[model samples]
Target: MTIIITGGAGFIGSNFIFYMMKKYPDYRIICLDKLTYAGNLSTLAPVMGKPNFRFVKMDICDREAVYGLFEEKNPDVVVNFAAESHVDRSILNPEIFLETNIIGTSVLMDACRKYGIGRYHQVSTDEVYGDLPL
Candidate 1:
């Protein structure tokens, strides 16, 4: 089955891909990433062109591109990891966070709902739970 992993270039998402690759070598992995500041392609360089692994660079907030990918790839599952993950960065530019984290997620969710996708996974931060006491 094909699984689309958004932001698969980022830390947690990339690691999850590695884990899944090892666990289920038979499955195909489609990594969809925008390569935002927190996303580093280098993290996924090791598995860039495996027979079961593929990468696509696109912003989740872009409705046409997102829908196009869904149509073209026809992924069986979607794991959304695209977001403004850093709280410090969000503090500096709240607009970016709002646009990426809130609006982008909304767009992705809408696309998933419309497409009748099999599964949708949202990657969220513990930072939203509030800072840890020092």
Candidate 2:
């Protein structure tokens, strides 16, 4: 099965990728990350060369690009870990947050509807819950 993991460069998302890779070696994993301040490409370095894994540097807010990805990947599942931060501060200026969190999520779901996906899981607010152990 192919699983498209959005925001896979962040700590929580990267951890999920590692866990999934280990748990399902046969699965095709497509990681889409915009590499914002919260996202670090180096975090996924360990799995970069894996045959079953692919990393795309793309923003979830970019509808055209996201749809292109959906076309290319034909993912069975889309786990949306993509989000924006500085919640309290950003609430004062929520454009970026809304674009990434709300609008971007809509784009993903629309693509899922057009392209067909078995599941779409949204994993959110690791920041609110506090950090998880690396």
Instruction: Give the lDDT of residue 50 in candidate 2.
Output: 100
Q: For every candidate structure, what is the RMSD over all alpha carbons to the true structure, in angstroms?
A: 2.6, 4.6
**In candidate 2, which residue ranges exceed 4 Å CA deviation?**
126-134
Which candidate has the top score in lDDT? 2
Worst 10 residues of 2 by lDDT: 122-131
lDDT tens digits by residue: candidate 1, 1-134? 88999889999999999999999999899998999888999999889979999999988888999999888878888988887767788778878876777777888888888888978888865432345779
**Model 2 per-residue lDDT tens digits across residues 10-124:** 9999999999999999999999999998999999999999999999999998999999999987899999999887668576876877778788888999999999886999887
TM-score of every model versus the real structure: 0.89, 0.90
Flag regions of model 1 displaced more than 4 Å: 126-134
